[model samples]
Target chain A: MKLHVHIKKKISEFSLAVDLEMTDGLLSLLGPSGCGKTMTLKCIAGIENPDEGFIKLGDRVLFDSRKKICLPPQKRRVGYMFQDYALFPHMTVRQNVLAGMGRRPDPASADPFLERFRIADLHDRLPEELSGGQKQRVAMARIAAQDPDVILMDEPFSAMDTMLKWELEQEMLETLSEAEKPVLFVSHDLDEVYRMGGNICCMKDGKTGNIISNEEFFEDLKNGNSELLPGWRILPPER
Target chain B: MNDMVNFLSGLDWSPLFISLKTGVVATVISFFLGIFAARKVVKASPGVRAVADGILTLPMVLPPTVAGFFLLLIFSARRPLGSALYTSFGIKVVQTWLGCIIAATVIAFPLMYRNARAAFEQVDVNLVYAARTLGMSETRIFWRVIMPCAAPGIVSGTILTFARALGEYGATAMLAGNIPGKTGTISQKIAMVIQNGDYRTAGFWVAVILIIAFLIILLMNVVTARHMKNIHRY
Candidate 1:
């Protein structure tokens, strides 16, 4: 499935103008904080409205400013995992997964998702009881349950410790490969983006750069091409 | 001790019951309406929200008697709404128990609305976005996520509303009047007894008020403390 997005929004700090397209693999949006990486994902997911824009996913017009059409997040068929995981504090892991399916208390349906994410044993536990990594698993399971056309994850590992982040990153890479859909992963860390190893869309000052292959992205970084990525400065050699 | 017992036996307890019934009915009505209003106002456009917030909170800021006067203007039997109700439904609010409920609800509703609004504002907005992305309907998200997160403030709001309703006097006195068995409340009873130079009876009523207020505050603290622990767990 293909996803196309061209949106413009006025933020208090800057005017966001994004134009991008993706299909059938993870496309990492790399940028420093406040560079509209999250805002672009929000626009595609229909969480935030754009002043004028068009977003199409697999021939479905999610948003078209000229047509005055804007799908609500519920109708966008786009799964989102927040930076904080955003697990419902009051619900158990099972309920959070079931919520994605929009089904009743049917353990049969929810069990597969929990099992898939390896969180089946923690089904009855509330989000507060889960470790950060477990919560990420539950969030992933919830998204997988929805089976949306596109998945948008905003800095999913930002809250985890470095050790846990590495562990989760390995698991996430496996999951994304199997997802086989347009996945927009937002992250500010160059190392994390490099590890993700996909098309990199660099953003700076609310504007998106060219979509470069992972090899080219790392190549440019290694060459100290800070012009392509803002908020990047090669460290001085040790004294 | 005997004199105290005799005085208790002679006490007219109708005022206590009436006040409690009024408080409960008003509080129940306010609880739903307040939450509903808070939700609406929270989702409304900024300009509309500002104006709506001001109007909703006006009764809490205004004098109770002034609020009662406005209630009188709307439901005074001579007014259009009051006349229609009287003619079509045979309902009379002025000088009736209904007057007591309306006055109390008007005076106390803001507490519920304000508290609920503040709580709703404090909710992590990303949770709502997450729910929406999960394909949950708006209603489901509201009930499942927003309500639970805002429960502590709502609980406190409910207790404050009930207490304020129970202690409502000026508006009740102005609209419902001190009808001995119909609309008379504890505060009006205490006032009437004290004005008649019955210091002992008035003091007893004062003690009852103090006890009820204390119990309500205690209940609030217990609930909030438990809620705080739950929040910290998150």
Candidate 2:
């Protein structure tokens, strides 16, 4: 599956104009904060409306400005894992995970993720009751349960300790890898990016300036094509 | 003095019952309307919000006599509503206890709305967002997330409305009139007793009212204190 997006939005002073196409698997929007990375993902998820842009995940035109076609976030079927995970505190882990289940709620799609994420035992626990790692797992299961066409993550592990982050990072990659659809994840850690294993898109000044393969990503960073963009970053390198 | 004592002592309690009947009904009615109006304001478009906020507060700011006049305008026999209530429904407002209730509700409504709106506004809308993301519809999210969190606010507004209704004077006297044992309220009762140079009777009723209002206020304070705690935690 492929998702195409061309978004232009002015957020206060800096304007973001993002035009990028991804052909399935995992695509990383590698950028620091305020680099328009999150907005690009939000445009695809139908959260924030861009000034002028269109996004299409296959035949579904999620957002088309000229036609004034804008599907709300609920209808987009693009699972978003907010930087904080945005899990519902009032709901038990099971209920949160169940949110993304099959429309018919066939146990077939959900049971496996719950079991895989190892949160099957924490089903009754509220979000506050769960540990940081458990919350991260529940987020994964919530996203996995829905059978979304695309999963979008914004700094998924930003709040956790490095160990917890690394631990959840592996779990996320494993679960997201199981689905056949595309996953567009955002991250600042160069190492986590390397661990996640995807084509990297380095964003700068509201534009995505580079889309380099893994080898090229590292080489450009070491050799300094990475320097062209100010505030450019190298995510935590893979161990 | 003995006759006055007997008249005050055996004052038929049915008027007290009727007064309570009006106070309670008025308070309940205003509470519901106020909550609805406040929720609408908080959730409304900017233009609608300004209009609703202003309209809701009119009862609070307008003279209770003005409210009586407006109610008279709205429900007088010559007016459409008055004509309908009198002719079509055979209902009456002038010198009627229900008219007192209507008058009381209008005056107390803004307190209910303002308090409830503050409570609702304090709620973190992110919780609502999180609920929606869990695939729950907006209504479900509201019932499950918004209302439970706003309960204390609702309760506080209810108590304030009840207290306001209990003390309502100008609109109740102006619209419903002080027909003893009929449209007359506790306030009217106290005023009439005092006018007749019945200080002992007035003092007795005043003491009794103080006890009752004090208890109610204490209960209201307890609820509000609990609500404040909830606001801090939630």
Which number leads on lDDT? 1
Alpha carbon lDDT of residue B62, candidate 1? 96
lDDT of 1 by residue, A1-239 (tens): 99999999997769999999889999999888999999999999888999998999999999999999999999999999899999998888988888888736566788988888999999899998888999999999999998999999999999888899999999999998999999999999887988888999989899998898998877666567855654554455573
List, residue by residue over B28-82, the lDDT tens digit for candidate 1: 9999999999999999999999999999999999999999899999998889999
Model 1: lDDT to the true structure: 0.91
Predictions: Cα RMSD each: 2.5, 4.4
- What's model 1's TM-score? 0.94
lDDT of each: 0.91, 0.79
lDDT of 2 by residue, A1-239 (tens): 88888889998999999888887788888877888888788777765789998898888998898999998767777877787777766667776777656344654456677798898888788777778888888887887776678888888877889888787878777777777778888887787888888888888888886567867887777655674344445554583
Clashing pairs in 2: A100-A145, A100-A146, A189-A235, A189-A236, A190-A235, A190-A236, A191-A235, A191-A236, A191-A237
Candidate 1: fraction of native contacts reproduced: 0.91
The C-alpha stretches of model 2 lying farther than 4 A from their native spots are A11-14, A100-114, A188-195, A231-239, B1-11, B78-85, B131-135, B197-234
